[model samples]
Target: MILSVPLSLGGLIATAPSARAVPSMARQTGYECSKCHTVFPELTPYGRRFKLGAFADSSEKWDERPWTQRLPFSAALQGSRTSTSDTAAGGTGSSDFPQNDKTILQTAAIYYGGKIMDNAGALVQYNYDGIEKRWGVEMFDARYANGVTVAGREMTYGVTLNNSPTVSDIYNSTPAWGFPHTGSAATQMPAASIVDMTLASKVSGVGVYGMWDDLLYFELANYRTAKTGFFRFMALGQSWNSDELAGSVVEGNSPYWRLALQKEWGPHSVAVGTYGLVSRLKQDANVPSLGANRYRDIAYDLNYQFISGEHSASSRLTWINERQRRNNAVISEGLASNSINTLKTLRIDAHYYFRRQWGGGVQYFRTTGSTDELLYNTGDSLMGSTNGSPNTKGWIAEINYLPVTNVKLALRYTWFQQFNGASTDYVPGRNASDNNSLFLMGWVLF
Candidate 1:
């Protein structure tokens, strides 16, 4: 039984901060990267505010001329090498490509992003996957924000048009922008949940979000199924697959909700937040479904950062529990033993930056859930389950060195404790350790 992951984008068991004056926001505001990011993506206090404002703030003279005049365009290139403990079982595309072969041009992307008007800003990406040999709409967001007062408290409210739920978020601590920034598209992981693993590029979403008193944040949004043709609108090209889409095919509209509270004083800042979504989805797009398979996923997150002098430190933790009602799958497909199931995922990471040049971080991830024999009963095949289980755990450690303000070099190693639900006898003859991997990559944004 093959289940479709809801998001076209996944944590990828795989897998740029703009540094310096990114010509985009920096040129528009005359502010340097240090004013917004300690390292790209990782935000400073002011950076968060800038994002909350929809990247529309500027201290420089407003050029009434078309932004096309300034040409705030940029591109990113990634080169990486992947090494596994054991040779992979040949499958599709580069899934079985040589591991220690010459470095691959993992990915390439171009963007036309940044403020379009005083109250509007956009960040759109066009990506080309070298391994899959495909073009895709990586991420797209267009926002309209304004300053307002809600009940006597300072507030910033905005309406966002985006391709995914968390892609419009101000903080990078959430699942969509979590650590491991980039991973080998070739790496494989065990069974996954709809919320944590998928749900990035498969659907379209629009929501209203805002922050009040610099302590409270809330958002309300809805998502619907999207097709490959939509990418042409952003000039991001097309989808990787022509058959069925990579994200959940929803019925009607799916509701998404998020809330957070934060505090800051001196050089320390901390925040706690909750986000969830209720989706009614189906597996096959070609065939009609008996009924919608329902998934209600709820999550909690915590982020803490402290910056003082030349030293900076930060930590992020997120946990999600997804409740599944498999009535449709059981009645129509007979692929599940139980009418209900549950899946859970937890991730934690910490990073330290020395003098804003060298950085190191460690991350741990775990996934577990109740299983149905039909869903987790098979062998060592790519989609098989050695045992009737959906469980996996691993550790990732990485180090980074900035060769320049806009470029970074990184090395990461991942060790597996359990794969496909077990450590030993995980399959007929293989051990989980065989999946351990090492990845080295170079990332840049300008």
Candidate 2:
């Protein structure tokens, strides 16, 4: 059965028996992921048991017939604003200029999660954009897992229906589940719009493969790019000769892949992984300025965690190697272009919980690039370009309060700056200087 409801930008539904509940409910029941998961996000023997229990809890014999009849639903609402330096030009064209002051409804979503039968379950979500006046699917995952044997050893095969980013946010790193995080740098990744809320398959074909008792875990996938035209807005005009516009369609085979591994010894756990994309495209002959036939990137990340009682601390390091190859024809023609370009970034974040209700943390990020090739079309003959290459940095500090179990409220302040040697005459001016921005957001799940 399908149901719809108006929701806050970031709200999420609760249908599964294991659905998150109010803190009071959690305390009253005295249960945590540990009761189900072997290692927090990773399910364990008890975790599977809880899933089975969720199905049992919704049986016809249960007293809450209405709630048990369907799945749990959740929703979230969010608003954001920004401030920047006047030195920055919005991009190409007068229309592209970003207004110095702005307010936006960042997100609104609805989700359903629960079991379908004894050994199967599903998770589905829909997101609406107030500004766009449209709704789209964000996540639809169906999973099945059972004991099995491989190479004469015991193992399990689990399947999933969506291709969410492998590692985007640290706090809500469930991969294919959860509401949008308004304050994560990884959200800018290209895969954000393509993978989420699509009919992509993994697990049996592309999934973590290893023995349950092994100290390490790993994953592999036959990654396929999502359909083109899925995003709400296309930056470039519908001109076939426009290199910037035509290059936006990153369809065909992903040539993209991911690898993740982690090990736990006592109270310490460590994880490392890499994910990136490689693709080839045809450029418009009319627009000789755009260069390159192939674009590729490689990224690596490492994480460490120390857990003890209510106190926990974690840190992460990530590096990216992005390359844009220049087309010989374009360079010889003397159009605005470069040969090879690359971008690298490093970020560190940490969080500490106080009694599981209140917590505080900070995150820092630094990005350096070989060239300024990443550009977005914003319509009205305008484009948005990153002003700096070689260096950009940002930081976020926040405190979270969870009055009830399933709900969370947070306040955060962020600052970011970009340095550019030359600016353009778009909305503002050329020779852009570093700019700073601040934002505050609140999130909840029910």
Please provide TM-scores, in order, for all candidate models, with all chains considered together. 0.90, 0.64
lDDT of 2 by residue, 1-446 (tens): 00001010011110101112212112222455334322223233333333323322233433234544344455655454444333234433223224324565545666655555554554554655433335655444445545566656655445443443342112222223222234321111110012111212211113332334333333344333333344222111123343423443333444445555667687677767766656544344345454335557676777666666665555666656666565686456543246565555455666666556667667675555554333221111122234323344556576666675445565655554332312233223432232333444444555
- For 180-249, candidate 1 gives per-residue lDDT tens digits of 6776744455655435335556678889999999999888998876654553353234453544342356
Q: Candidate 2 — what's its lDDT?
A: 0.40
Best by lDDT: 1
- Candidate closest to the true structure, highest TM-score: 1
In order, the Cα lDDT scores of the candidates are 0.70, 0.40
Question: In terms of TM-score, how similar is model 2 to the real structure?
Answer: 0.64
lDDT of 1: 0.70
lDDT of 2 at 9: 7
Stretches of model 2 off by over 4 angstroms after superposition:
1-70, 79-105, 130-133, 150-154, 167-180, 183-214, 225-248, 281-292, 326-336, 372-390, 420-434
